[model samples]
Target: MSSFQNDTAHFAGLTEKQTATARLLAEGFTAKEIAARLTISESAATKRIEALRQKFGGITKNELARLAREEFSGSPSSHTVKVFEKNRDFSRAPDGEKLTWKNFDLPNTDGFRNSMPRNRPETELNFSDGFTLDATPPWRARREERLVPEVLDGEHAAPARWAYVVGAAIGMAILLLVLLAVADALGNLA
Candidate 1:
């Protein structure tokens, strides 16, 4: 028997639909193509693929395919896949009327008292006294004074400063030499 057939034999409990989906996926068919072939929605095909991934304890489609192939081919895999029960109660919302910020007591920071949205109570949105909305750009404000390190602001910086000066002087000299060479070549041509 082919490896794929052998692998499928090991997973005999798979539903007919799951088996068909897996076969198509193993054959490199995209979810859209599989959906069309199976007469199902693309989202349904994607969900099937995700379900297969979860069943095989695979984080990726490729891993899921490998797991399927290994299981079908009678190869023993080290990882054990766990099945989880779906929780219906987790999807339920709390049983109560919707509560807005107006229902709670909050302090207003800004002097403007009427900034709350229409129909909402004044206590809905409150800013603390420490909060200040400055219209000016943050960068334009006076910055805290910082002390400069001696290496950067004192005689310790002389060596680096001199190095920059010497480097600039050398670059200028090279530029002048190149210009002079060009001028000499033009003069020779004339």
Candidate 2:
């Protein structure tokens, strides 16, 4: 087993950004090395590492480094995945087929808030309109699988509650009763 595997407590509370710094650091990276890996400024890496240490309440740089190596694999964590999934707005295509990424949100990112991020994976899953049907790898198989569920999920979004139907029926009955009362009043006046 890796020496790092047993030291999980030292790496607790490392955020996504810190995990990145830690992975580079574990490979004997300098602050500049960490920055280069993430395409950020050296001071950005340094300050981020500092902030990470503070968040974890580490008393020394070594302690911070220890935590980062323990927790930071330089990729999104399970919790991060959950956050992103929760933020994404899923829908069937307007035609109720074709699982599309045409205008799909990226879950929790600010990019998703303003607009959908591009599906720019190295395999070139994009179509002519900058959309991708590649939810999983090997696009054709996944695309076809999406068709039935897309239609059904969209159809299911329409209200299926008994309460809504009952409420509508009650509302219609009340409106008819009001009309009948008005007609009776007019007849007495005539």
Question: Scored by CA lDDT, what does every candidate get?
Answer: 0.63, 0.57
Tens-digit per-residue lDDT, 56-151, candidate 2: 444346544533443455433311211112233446323322222255445666646676546556676744866667356664454344544443
Minimal lDDT window, size 10, model 2: 77-86
Each model's TM-score, in the order given?
Answer: 0.32, 0.30
lDDT for 171 in candidate 1 is 100
TM-score of 2: 0.30
The residue-by-residue lDDT of candidate 1 on 1-190, one tens digit each, is 1112233343566788888887787666889999999999999999999887665444457545545555545545413432222322323423321111122446775645657555666677675787687577866846566564555567668886777679999999999999999999999997
